[model samples]
Target chain A: MTLILDYEAGNLASVKRACKEVGLDAEFCADGDQLRHAERVIFPGVGAAGSAMRSLAHRGLDEALREVILRGVPVLGICLGLQVSLDHSEENDTPTLGLIPGRVRRFNLDRTDLKVPHMGWNEVVPCRPHPVLAGIDPGDEFYFVHAYYTDPKVADCVLARTEYEHSFASAVGYNSYIGTQFHPEKSGRVGLRLLANFAAWDGQC
Target chain B: MLSKRVIACLDVRDGRLAKSIKFVDTKDIGDPVEKARAYYLDGLDELVFYDITASSDRRSIMLDVVESVASQVFIPLSVGGGIRSVSDATDLRLAGAEKINVNSAAVQRPALIDECAAAIGNQNVVLSMDVRRVEPTQALPSGYEIVINGGRQPMQMDALAWALDGERRGAGELVVNSIDADGTKEGYEIALTALISSSVRIPVIASGGAGKPEHLHQVLTEGKADAALVASMVHYGEYRVSDLKEYLQRQGLKMRMSW
Candidate 1:
């Protein structure tokens, strides 16, 4: 059973709906015990990193999440979920759950054309193959509404790279844990396909 | 490269999908949920739901409608109309809307943008403005004046200045709706859109007046808008979302065509 981590940061309904559409039975998991017992965990969020980390710490789900990843359980992080999995975030100057050795940095492009929040559909270019990104083709766009992006210390952890003003780690993975900066739940058909792939992903590659 | 977005605007009046000509003489067309589902199936990039009558009655948005539409549509859903507080924005977000657009209420209380930004991040807060073309004056120098109450009331505020103010107040994006070209299907107000798009660093969605794919292309390129919002063009079946996308693609504009 897949449990979606609910830390009370933003909406979980669309993520839940997307999981259902992909034939995956997912429920909100706020307690640490349920999170540890889940076969796979989907960590999704869409708000500030500071408050999100506070909520996770408040619920004691933070330590449980680190344990789940260490236990080799498949964990998928989306947007803020992915950002907070890093060591620290420039957003609100908050420290995150050090699942991956990296930092989340905000976009400070000098170009006027490349706007902050980088909102809208952009292509996700796969840097290497991974089970969760199976059906995602080259130039297949995903919905992204974020200002900050993950910068993993290990280059091999980056599964895919996307460009706005420059190349950034759009998808990163470590062992059984995977993270995507784009929202698969909101990417339409291509997004649903990614979710379907995640449902069947064994966290092997 | 990021693809230019093609968003379908659904104006809901009293729970029914409706179309308006310059914000008046609205005709109920079909069910919003069904329409949203159909558009989603047709490879639409995003969707915007405007609760047309919510402001007048001081009623909240139709969450049931948003919920039903969001259940089926996997694309990003942005909802506006009668969102006066963070609670209202939170309700829509809980109902599966990724973004909440605030127009009239935000104009009335400029701090609403700041409050919503604090509550639900700035990226999800879209500042929607309904503007009318006016002669350039000392106070309203952009020649575009911000109008509220579904274009019935003028706020005497300059549109360009308001755009900057909204961005400063933590709005991530702006939906520049032109009352002059809305539902007319002639074309978008290129000058108006270009002015705001050039002035702000945030993404600008040029709303109102899209008859064909060419108009969309024009607004995206010439008007310098990041996205184009259409209503009557797709709502009345004049053109499908695919037709518009294909046309734009052929015209050398990158679009998400994975469907």
Candidate 2:
């Protein structure tokens, strides 16, 4: 039973649908107890960091998620979910859950042609061997729509890297927690395969 | 490098999939969900669903179809047609649409773009414009005029100016649908596409005349479009999304190879 933590951010339905398509029994677990006891938790979000943190804090799921991660339960974060796991964010100058040793900063592209928000599909280059990227090809494209990105303090935590105006961390994994800067739910077959890999993972580092 | 996208646009009227010839002589093709599934399997980069009559009919969008198609297709789904307010955008988002496109409504009230962006995020708000070419007038110095209400009404706004305004108003993406070349299948209005695509930093999707794979390559490269929206070419079964994508890939355009 995989629980999709619901904290008022959008993309919950799409994430649940992706999990189901991957043959994982998933449910929206707004209740903290369900989130804590689920086999795996997918912390998905798509919004501002300040408001997302507020919603999680409002529902008291912030500490609940920390407890679940500390218990060696496999967890995956998507987009803003990846940003919120960092130490701090430039968006609203908000402090995040700090589950991953990193800070989220907006893209500072020097090129005039490069667009902000960084919307669309780009290649995901795997940096290390991890179960979440077991079947995904090194240059397989994933759907991305973000203005901010994660800069993990520990270089080894970087799972994959992608280039836009400049190369940035697109996926990160540490301990039992893994997060993707792109929306795997909307990335077609490659995305579904990644979700399945996460579902079958045994929470190994 | 970011790949060029091939999007399948379904113009649905009521509950059935409808295709138009130059925005008229409409004919029902097939089920939208089934077509969406076929496109999804064929590895189309994205999908766009427009409730064709919702705006002209003056009603809300068909959420049932949006929900049904969204459940089956797992790619980035963008829904448009009758999105008038922030609430309409919210409803579509709840129904599993990744992006909501505003056309006539945004022209009526430009603030609707900002409101929807605030309600959702800027990335989820798409501004779709129906544009027609005309002589360069004082009001529309770009020679392209903005048409609304399913291309039945013309506005004083210029296509290039409206696109820039939309981006400033917080629209994350823009769909420049050429009313003159829509459904003609002759080729994309490259001049119109290049004009708007170069003027905006946001991603621009060139909609309207997509007859062959070569047309897509032309727009994506020469026209500088981020994505190409296909209608009659794919809707009539003249070409599969895979065939078009493969042809584009061969032309040195970066495309996601599903198979």
Candidate 3:
């Protein structure tokens, strides 16, 4: 069964609903043991990174998540879930799970034309092929709402890039771990297509 | 590039889609969930559900409506109307709303914005202001005043000042609804919208007074609004969301049409 990590930072109801819509039966799993044994894990949330890390650590889910990725279990991280998967985040100066070699930085745009948080729908151009982004086209846009963005260290780790103030890694993956800066659950049909792709993805690039 | 958003505002009253002219003389339109699904199918960028009455007793009804709509419709859903405390905002967020809009409550106690932003991130907090064009006083230099309680009470607050203040208090976006042109279909208040949009760095949604697609074009281009919120134009089935997106796209504006 597909499990969504519930660390109190995510909108679990919406994610569960989207999974059901995509014909994927999913349930909220807060137990680290349950998460480790799950066939697929969907990590999703919105909020500060420090608090999210704290909550995960408090529940011992941080180590459990790292273990899940290392075991080749399919893992998908969304929004803050994606941010906390990196090495560190500028938000709260918190250290995050080092599943991917990178750091999360806040959007420091000097242009008045672009707003921080990037709260709207924008295009996600796939830079490389990945299973989770199978049907996402060049023109397909996803819902994004975050002040900070993932900046992966290795060039090959960047799966997709979106332009706002500059081209940032909107989607990143390393080994069995896949993360997106946008919310697939909230992007309408194109977004649902992404969730369906994730449901079918077998942790293979 | 971030495309300009086209938002459909559903003024829900008694669990039904309702509409009013100048925030009075309300009329039932239809079921909100059905209309929301229809708009979602038509490739509407975002949806906003404003509980028009927002009385304390009817809070659960609004949540049920939001939950149903968010479960079926997968666009970014923003809910406003009766959010008085951080818990209220949290409840809606848990019920599947991506953003919580604070208007009268924020004006009553501005700290509610900061509190909600702290609980939920700053990105999920939206400040929706009901603005009326008034004589430019020394205190209200922008020539606009803020109204509260569904446009019934005047707050004597300057629109420009409130917009800036809302931004300072951690509001991620602003919904500037012109009380003068709410249901008039004359088009948005260009000067007022432009004033707030230019003054604040956060994205501003130009709301109220969208008669046709060209009005949206004007507001998005000349008025410099990041998004245009429509109620009457799309509510009465006069124009479909696809028609508006197609018209705006033809007029050289980027819109999200790939549903």
Candidate 4:
């Protein structure tokens, strides 16, 4: 069973349904006990980083989430969940778990022509070989909705990236903790393939 | 980069597909699933089913119709009308809808955006505003008031300000429909749309007044909307999706046509 960390961050029903649609059972876990017993864990986030950071702090789920990912449990962070995995986010001016070495920065745009909160479906191209993205192709479209991205120094940490106003890291892999800026559940077939790969892969970190 | 979107808006009443001319003359447009699938194959990018029936004891969104369409189509589906609470949002999701659009109900309680955004991801919650250039009236900016209950009542709000506020309140995207131009096929209100688009941090969908392929191109290029939603033109077969996409490409707009 995959434990979905729930701190009122993002309980994407479709994400849960997508897992079930693929025949994997996931439980929304907001407590440490549930995380301790689960085989794997997922950090799903939607909404603003400021509000999300507040929600995580308010529920005290921030430390609980950090503990689980630090224990080397295969954990996946989606969107804002990925943002919170960093050291600091410009969004909420809040500090992240620092599980991954990076800072979340706003999209760098020279012109006001491009929209912020870069919403909608965009493509993802993986730069490194990893089990979760075993069969995915380059330039595969994935659903993305965010205003910030990570600037990590560790080259090995970058797994996938996509271009908008500029190219930025879309997915980062470190140890067993994986963070995806896109919602794999809503990303159609390619997304499901990535999730299925995650579900089947043995702890490799 | 995002491609131009062609939306098949299903107006349902009393649990069936309902379409009307100018919000009056009504008809059943066959099975919504078949209609939507035909559009999907025709290269439509998105689907929006407006619950025109919910307000009038005369209409209600057919959840059954939505479920049928959802099972057959994988594209993003947005359902609006009579969505008042988080339960309503969940009910639509359980019915297989990818997004729940709240209009009148959300303005009544801004926190409803939070309620829905918290339960379901904010991306799944769309806040659609029915805006019109009301006669320059009392203590308001530009006389652009938010219309609710199917444009039957006016709320004291500015369309431009609401766009930014909606995003701040946690709406994934804003669908700004120009009530004055809806179904007119005249063209989009570029000035109004651009004002709202530049004001907001999220992508804005331009709705109403799409008459020709040029209109789509104009709004997308000149108006600078991330996407344009066409309903009547596609529904009545005024123009084919193939023709529209080709026209957009010729005009130098980037769009992916998946067959």
Task: Tell me each candidate's RMSD, in Å, in order.
Answer: 1.6, 1.7, 1.2, 4.3
Per-residue CA lDDT of candidate 3, range B1-259, in tens?
Answer: 8899999999899899999888888999899999999999999999999998656667899889999998899988999998899999988988889899999999999999999988887888999999999999998899999999989999889999999999999999999999998888999999999999999989999999999899999999889999999998998889999999999999988888799
Q: How much is the lDDT of residue B65 in candidate 1?
A: 86
In the range B80-185, model 4's lDDT, one tens digit per residue, is 8888899888877777687889998888888999888888876788899989886666645766888887777877788777777789888888888888888678
Q: Clashing residue pairs in candidate 3, if any?
A: none
TM-score of 3: 0.98
A9: Cα error in model 4, Å: 1.8
- Poorest 10 consecutive residues of model 1 chain B by lDDT? B53-62
- Candidate 1 lDDT score relative to the true structure: 0.91
TM-score per candidate, chains pooled: 0.97, 0.97, 0.98, 0.80
Q: Whose DockQ is greatest here? A: 1
Candidate 1 regions off by >4 Å?
B54-61
Model 4 residue A130 distance off true place after TM-score fit, in angstroms: 2.3
For model 3, the stretches where C-alpha displacement exceeds 4 angstroms are B54-56
> B43, model 1: CA deviation in Å?
1.3
DockQ of 4: 0.23
Fnat of all models, as shown: 0.84, 0.57, 0.83, 0.20
Using DockQ as the measure, name the better of candidate 1 and candidate 4: 1
lDDT of every model, 2 decimals: 0.91, 0.90, 0.91, 0.77
